[model samples]
Target: MASDIIIVGQGICGSLLSWSLLQKGISVKVYDIDADHSATAAASGIINPITGKRFVKSWMVDELFPAADKTYSEISQAIGVHFYEKLPIYKLLESVKEQNDLSARATETGYEQYFTNTDVQYLDKGKVKNEFGSFVINGGGKMDTQLFINSYRTFLKNKGILIEEPFTYEQALVSKSKVIFCNGYKAAQTGFFRDLTWQIVKGEYLLVRIKDFYADRIISGDTTISPTSEKDIYYAGATYQWHYETEAPTEQYKNEIIESLNKMLHVPFEVVYHGAGIRPSAKYRRPFIGFHPEYKHVGIFNGMGTKGISLSPYFAEHFAEHIVNGKELLPEVDVKNILIKS
Candidate 1:
């Protein structure tokens, strides 16, 4: 089949980029192996603006958050499904050092937009362990990524642009147009882009039903408790394993998540689901964009890491424009390096 673009993998990146191109009236043929346990399927899709021990704002949160909201909302309307929400994240403080550090940032002039004074108190005292207190960031939320991706997949299938199967680089017949790899961790093993710094990691998460322990907003402490469309059901996770044996979920990590959940909650909960996937993290910790220097028609849109929710939508539009209009990419994210070659 002839197309303007050929996309591999229907993860978050491929879904968004293809949607962007379709919006511009461009043609796309997406190839996938129907990997039921892909990263995007297991992701909590939490778009947290505040992160780390210091609670610093994420890189390009101002830009990425808005773009994500706009893209997800618009596509949701098109797909007849609501996938994104604007809810605050209540970060449970662990120590006095963290409390002090947060206080400084909360008092700073530029921080008020995301953080507020009322967000600094012992907010969830009766609900969760808030001895040190919890701070809230207003401009953060979660996306039902699996639902969105699934819906988008159906949409593509309906349009006759989706191939629900594996695609090998050796067997690619339609190679005239650009072929962008959005294949997540598997992209590193493709043998073509092996020179790119791929620091993939395994992430495990659980979905549980906590009785009467409902907090409308997301809770981030020992782990993240993200609310779903259902009542009292939250997506809880995740454990980062740098060196791991298999991609499948383990009983040991499931126990670890339960332990962390116990640390945050006083009530009982039942584990409904346990799943694991790999993140395509880069050594430089930025997304990999632009075409391959050797194979100019072959490009990549991977390395979204743990921030795929916040990163993919914006970069999808950016990279889509770069292809459709010959525009330049964000210099820091563009993968052209003379310093190191492999």
Candidate 2:
């Protein structure tokens, strides 16, 4: 069946795009090959306003945060799932230089609104050798991606808009008006995007049942500890590697996370679940969203990286506006401008 849009890979990007387009009365058919390690499935969905060693605000946080909050809230109400939670991120500062750098950046960048200077007391301070740190970031939260995906999947199934199998490349038919590639990483093998630099990083996370370290906030260092309602279970992880034998959790990664967590808190926990997925990260780190250089009808809205939860909503809305209203694309993020040069 010919639809207004045929989306490949029902990960966070595809799912959110379908939701956005459908809200505008556009018809979208989604083809998905389920993978346990798909980024959406493995992501902790933390949307931080400030990131990196420099502690600068993320790209377009002021604009993206409001849109993301509204979008997720609307989806939660529509799907009857509690998927958004605003949480305090406790960033560990291990040195005086790091603290000074963060302080200077906050003042120079006018990002002081997002952060404050605070001291954190670690339960297991002896586990690792460190000193004082600060927690100044504001407007950060977590999205329950698993719950959101399950609810949306059910919604799609009920509407008869979801295909559960891998999309066959042989079945794709391109023309002057449109081209459909409905497969996930499988699309990488297709001739259309082979020349594009696509870097896939495999990551792994562990679901642990630790009872002693009970907090409503998220803790980040070498690894992050995200709180869950169960009181005993927390989502901790993940390790990133560009070269790996496969997209599976390794014992080495599992041990690394456990060791990291042990340093954060004084508690014993059992590993309940382990998951891994590959992120479609680009060298430029901006999302790719435009038609192929030669094929105008062939467009893409991928490359969300680790920030998919926060980036996808705004970009999806932007893409929808471009498709439905003939709006001028923003040059800073326009895929055409990035891929094609004058």
Candidate 3:
């Protein structure tokens, strides 16, 4: 019933935070309402070092990428699952303007270390349309989020730390030294972050079976495709919608993604599965971290948005350190500095 830390969500954020806390010899009690369609489950977990349009380096690629790789690798070994893989992303450009903009931006940002204007003539001869595009092969890859969560959950359960049910918010107790909320989105309904703008977007993706286009690398364009190594099975997805009826997959999104895929590839494929989840994106797109102003013990580690895979590890360690050792939080990402005043 009591723990040094009570985490109310077993998604990537909560899972990683729990792991970090346990590593520091802290007792963590994690509560979750089983898995729902959320970014962690639906995420392709791609950690691109460069942004798509700007081709600029990610916010903290030099640091975050290495830390993420090391963390995932260590955790994967401990849990006996392949959780991380380094893959080069082949970005397909559709128009001359996009190509030009990419080139100019790369030059301006000195992103040539990753970006190059290569003759993708081989791809041009394929059935798909190609207006000629540049390639930016950066050091980034994907995380098997679902596998990681399930494996970690099992690990925690074996260690007698996981509670596989929804935590009742009414049970949460907030005191001067500690505060707890039920889950990430549930915090919104609790009115804790009423002043903070939450831009919850629903995203959907489909699994497809396609033969002969197998590659260890990840392909990103209008629609991204990740090869799963299962013959003729690949993860192709993802449509982002600002407004949606529910967090369930829709035929409208499936058709749109499939149509987009048809435009990029010449091969035939069969639709296998569809998944949808709502991402807890913030208005400013930075993660929401810190304790409540009025409630000193209440803290949050949510809002990594789509970058949860890359962001969670570093921030989790940072947060755990802050909690355990009285260390100073990072200036840019410290939650206390970013909290919206009520």
Candidate 4:
């Protein structure tokens, strides 16, 4: 069947891209192997507004956050599934400096909505490591990333627009459809987007069984512990390994995560599941979006890195507009930046 577009890799990026295209009344034939170790599958899908060592705001959070909320809400309603979670991100104060940084931001006018300096106790029971206290990020949320993508996949299948297989560039045009690579870190192996400086790394997390633990909001310490789609099973993780030999789970990092969790959490917990997946993080920490220089019909939409959950929906819509209307992508993320150096 000749379709308007053929998207590769049905991760968050691909799924959002397909949805955006489909919403615009475009036909999209998706290709995905549905790997068990995909990043989207392993992700807790927490959409944090502020992050990093200094606890600064995430890139484009002001704009992207609201768009994501709207997109997820509309999609959830359309599919008859509840995947988006609107909750606070309680950042545990680890040190005096970290405490001061947050304090300074709370007084600032622009940061008022996202940061609250009011003395609040989210997890201060000595069981979850918050001796210094924590602040609330008002508009933080999470999405059941895997659940949303999987459900959307079934929706596409019913529409006769899905191919449950890996796509290779060799099969393009022979099928007469524009192919956009929405595959995550796997795109690093393909030569088409080799100009992109990928800082790919495998991230590890755990699905743990903890009794009577309240998961009203996400908790952060050395690692982030967010609620999973399932009740009572929180997603605890993630550790980054630059020199990992396999994307498969490792016992060393699993124990490492447990150690970190123990510091934040004094409770004894059992590891119900361990998951590891590679992120397509960019060297400059920007997404690689837009078309190939030589292959006009081939485009790359990867390199979302750690912020894929928050960033993908906004960019997916932008990318769709670009494809459908020949609109301009911001110079920073434009694929022409890669071609300029090439």
Candidate 5:
């Protein structure tokens, strides 16, 4: 079938890019196998404005968060499926130093949006531990990644643009339409865009069910625990491993998550699922966007890393504008500038 663009991979990148393109009246044919190891499938889809050990604001949060909210709402309305939600984050302070740091950050001029509640928030003593105290962070939420992806895939299928198969470099080279690779870490493996530098990371997580322990908001401490649509089930512990022998889940990481859960929760829980995925990150920590230098017809929209939920929608719209209306790509994320160093 003829299309304006052919997209490889149906992860968050591919899905959002296609959505953006479709909004611009562009036709797209997507290629993907929906592999079990998809990073989007394993992601908890937490969009936390305040992150890191220092408890500072995430990069580009002000711009990215609004774009995410708009794009997700648009897609949800179009598909008639509700997957995006704005939930507060309950950041549990681990030490006195962390408490002091948060206190200082709350006094900062621009941090008031996220750090509104400086008072220590307490939870039920039997349900979860809050000895060191915790604070509520606004301007953050969770995306039901699986639901969004599934609903959008169905949307594409109805339009006859969804091709459930793997697309390789050989096919990409000869495709009539411009081909864009939205595949995750496997893009590094293919070596098609060899000029780009990558810092691939493997992340693992668990699905646990705690009886009668319901969390209305995301609980963050040693690990993040976010509620799912299913009652009593929550996502926990996405460990970031810079070095790993394989992309598969490990017992060590699973146990580590269990240990953290034990420390954070006073109630007993049952682990129902374990999963992992490799995240393709750029060395400088920005998405790799734009066509390849040599192969003008080939393009990429990957390397979103841990911030895919926050980054993908806004950047997908940006990338789509560049393709449709001759808009200049962002200087920081454009691939031309990124490859010059390599």
Candidate 6:
């Protein structure tokens, strides 16, 4: 019997989407070449409740956070690998204006959840530079992207549903089951969804080992410093380049991250790894989740951008519902609506 669906690309998006469908008793065959430096692997996996220069809550944080927490927890138990961690974010204030802005924003009605206590002072002056003080943000955490993806891939392989190879559109055309492309920025280069407005971004980061510096929480300064599953090794990043010549990691970006680390850390650190990945940001900064307008069987669940870690699980379940039951897709995320607006 033919599988219910064929998922192309086994990144976080693809992994979660297939898992969601499988949990609903739908059979799925996943195709992926497993590139060495994909976007999912390079992600810092930091889920901040607030974002941007204005320090406003992230887009859809209220719904996204709860869904992410529940889904990651469920998947962790299913796979027996603890990958999701709820940790506070220590945001170092860059200037007095920033401190004042946050102080004022904290008094607002809805902002109190993330900024309940801004009086937390930056105490480790000897270890970290704190010329302007900082605050601890609640409802922020990190996901072990590598562990989750790798272990889940293994789980799929054990089930004999994962096919390790390049999947082309021609194969998708001939497939008996519905095919959804979960490929990253590469989707913009080829396939039916190429015409859709794509704001492809290239992000680069560094993996560093800082001796004698212990951080149980995520540190957000000029660059975000997130802990990994490994001891003493942290993921520091990242430089966002809206226009870049290549997806490969450049020395210039590596030095740029090092400079930011120097500004925040008083201690010396060694660069263990440098990586880069291309993000598939949509025109309106939303995801594309639905079937194509013309070719109904060919669908997409890409364009999660930097928020793939938090967005995937929620959206995956949503897309699965749309596929399983006759649920209406949100106008913002519905590809038909998005393409019509564009």
TM per candidate comes to 0.95, 0.89, 0.90, 0.95, 0.96, 0.96
Q: List the residue pairs that clash in candidate 4.
A: 173-176
Candidate 5: where are CA atoms >4 Å away? 1-3
Native-to-model Cα distance after best TM-score fit, residue 57 in candidate 1, in Å:
1.1
Candidate 6's residue-wise lDDT over 296-332, tens digit each? 8889999998789888888999999999996888888
Candidate 2, clashing residue pairs?
37-277, 114-138, 115-136, 116-136
| Model 5 Cα lDDT, one tens digit per residue, 1-342 | 346799999999999999999999998899989744588878999999988888888888989999999999999999999998999898888888877888888789889888778777887778889887888899999998888888888999999999999998998888778999999888888756755888898899999998887568999988889999889999997999999997789999999999999889999999999999888788888999998877788899999988899999999999999999989999889887777656
Better of 4 and 5 by lDDT: 5
User: Which residue pairs come into collision in candidate 3?
Assistant: 179-297, 289-335
In candidate 2, what residue range of length 10 has the lowest lDDT sum? 175-184
> What does candidate 1 score in Cα RMSD to the true structure?
1.9
Candidate 6 clash pair list: none
Instruction: Give the CA lDDT, 0 to 100, for residue 187 in model 2.
Output: 46
Best by lDDT: 5
Candidate 3, residues 59-171, lDDT tens digits: the string is: 77677777788878888887888977888777777777767766676665556655554334234335344557536566778877677777888888888988877665445
Q: lDDT per prediction? A: 0.84, 0.73, 0.73, 0.83, 0.88, 0.87
Which pairs of residues clash in candidate 1, taking residues 3 or more apart in a chain or in different chains? 32-165
Q: Rank all candidate structures by their TM-score, best first, as comma-separated numbers.
A: 6, 5, 4, 1, 3, 2
What stretches of model 1 exceed 4 Å from their correct place?
Answer: 1-3, 172-174, 338-342
RMSD of 6: 1.4
lDDT of 1 by residue, 1-342 (tens): 346698988999899899888888899999988646678988998898878877788999889988998998898898898888888888888888888888888877767878865446665466688788887788888888778778888899899999987877765433877788888898787645667888988999999998776557888889899898878789999889999998899999999999998898877889998989999988878999888777677888889999998999999999989988989998777765511354
